[model samples]
Target: MPQMSPLNWMSLYILFIFVFLIFNIINYFLFLYSPNQNKNFKKKILFNWKW
Candidate 1:
């Protein structure tokens, strides 16, 4: 059996955090600029009828 070094564990934790942040950033931008979201909103507004 082998024991992991503290430095190695710290590096792995940092890497995981970096990856998680990048994933969230990508998701934010994708959702923020997604044409489909805007399209759906516009369609609803354009087709919504008020009597």
Candidate 2:
């Protein structure tokens, strides 16, 4: 197999990261999140603390 140069590897890494970020951003906005529901979601995530 032909070895990739550092520049090629760097470009591939950056490309994958860029694609991953775009995918996450798309998924984030794909949901219809209202402020009220956002608050409700956060409230549900509260951990029950015990000492």
Candidate 3:
């Protein structure tokens, strides 16, 4: 197999990191901005249980 140059390897690494950061930021805001009812959907189910 042919060897990768240092710049190519570095750019790939940086791109992977940048994408990871962007995904996490998007997830964080989604969690933050989601409605309270949506977040507590499971809790509401348990609250109605008789046991």
Candidate 4:
């Protein structure tokens, strides 16, 4: 069996975290700037919250 060194594990963990954050940021921008999404989405969300 083979095992990764502690430094390799740490770097892998950091890379995973960086990728996760970048994915979230890209998703946020897509949602915020997409032309198909508009104030209607916000209004619908607020309306649903009222229930």
lDDT of each: 0.80, 0.83, 0.81, 0.81
TM-score of 1: 0.55
Best-fitting candidate, measured by lDDT?
2
Per-residue lDDT over 1-51 for candidate 2, one digit per residue giving the tens place of the 0 to 100 score = 347687798999999999999999999999858775444454447677984
Give the alpha carbon lDDT tens digit for every residue of 6-46 in model 1: 77889999999999999999999888963554544543356
49, model 2: CA deviation in Å? Answer: 42
Clashing pairs in 3: none
Question: Among all windows of ten consecutive residues in candidate 2, which has the lowest summed lDDT?
Answer: 35-44
TM-score, predicted candidate 4 vs. hidden true structure: 0.55
lDDT of 3 by residue, 1-51 (tens): 236687788999999999999999999987886445554455434565776
Please estimate how well model 4 matches the true structure, expressed as its whole-model Cα lDDT: 0.81
Q: What lDDT is obtained when candidate 2 is compared to the true structure?
A: 0.83
TM-score per candidate, chains pooled: 0.55, 0.55, 0.55, 0.55
Q: State the weakest 10-residue window (summed lDDT) of model 4.
A: 37-46
In model 3, the worst 10-residue window by lDDT is 37-46
Clashing pairs in 4: none
- lDDT tens per residue, model 4, 1-51: 237687788999999999999999999988895456455554434456666
